[model samples]
Target: MPIAGPWIQLAVKPTAFDSDDRGTWLIFDGLLQAAGAALLIAGIATSGGDEEPALSILPSAGPHHAGLSLAGRF
Candidate 1:
């Protein structure tokens, strides 16, 4: 894939539409993939390979919901 593959997909997303004229799902796919790849690259670039990234996971709850609260520093 090209370095700008995701961006290219997003650029051409408009023309990928069908006759229904709905917004292209490729835009979301491209954006999400791009964001994930960026984050991965950032993490790899910032890590020294010896120091582990800081992280904390705590139980979280609300009136009608409960989930894990994740916090971290990379």
Candidate 2:
């Protein structure tokens, strides 16, 4: 099938860039993946040892007045 060629190419020589558009896309995809991985690592590293429960605040607005509600698992 027509789709087989591209799949074969990707598998045979993984680093090969078949065309300029594909090359650019590969580069951008790699950058985004790296960024996501870095953020994940940073988040894990920065989380303190304290096992304190997480907290969150939600704000609601209606036709009359607005109010803030706090939620947590202390």
Candidate 3:
């Protein structure tokens, strides 16, 4: 819906937008937004489920250093 703002503006009051190629740019913007949404939906719908995700963190210390180790699975 947010992506339709420009289209609505152009339709209701074409003179509001001052861009030289407002229609062209709006078309491009709509296409890009649609493509991005499609990709996002595809990614979420097809995410892998083969492994149970896991994560662990371990603290480590040495003579002159201290750090944490991170391990994970997705």
Error of 1 at 49 (Å): 13
Better of 1 and 3 by lDDT: 3
In terms of TM-score, the best-performing candidate is 3
Candidate 2, RMSD to the unseen true structure: 8.9
Compute each candidate's TM-score over C-alphas. 0.41, 0.42, 0.52
Q: Which residue pairs in candidate 2 collide?
A: none
In model 3, which residue pairs have backbone atoms overlapping below 3 Å?
Answer: none
**Residue-pair clashes per candidate, as listed?**
0, 0, 0
User: Least accurate stretch of 10 residues (summed lDDT) in model 3?
Assistant: 10-19
lDDT of each: 0.72, 0.64, 0.75
Ranked candidates (lDDT, high to low): 3, 1, 2
lDDT of 2 at 62: 93
Per-residue lDDT of model 2, residues 1-74, tens digit only: 23244444445555755555764554566566667778877876675677775899999789998999898654
lDDT of 2: 0.64
**Model 3 lDDT tens row, 1-74:** 75676677667655655658877777787778778888878866674877666789989889999999898765
Once fitted onto the true fold, the runs of candidate 1 whose alpha carbons sit more than 4 angstroms away are 1-32, 47-52
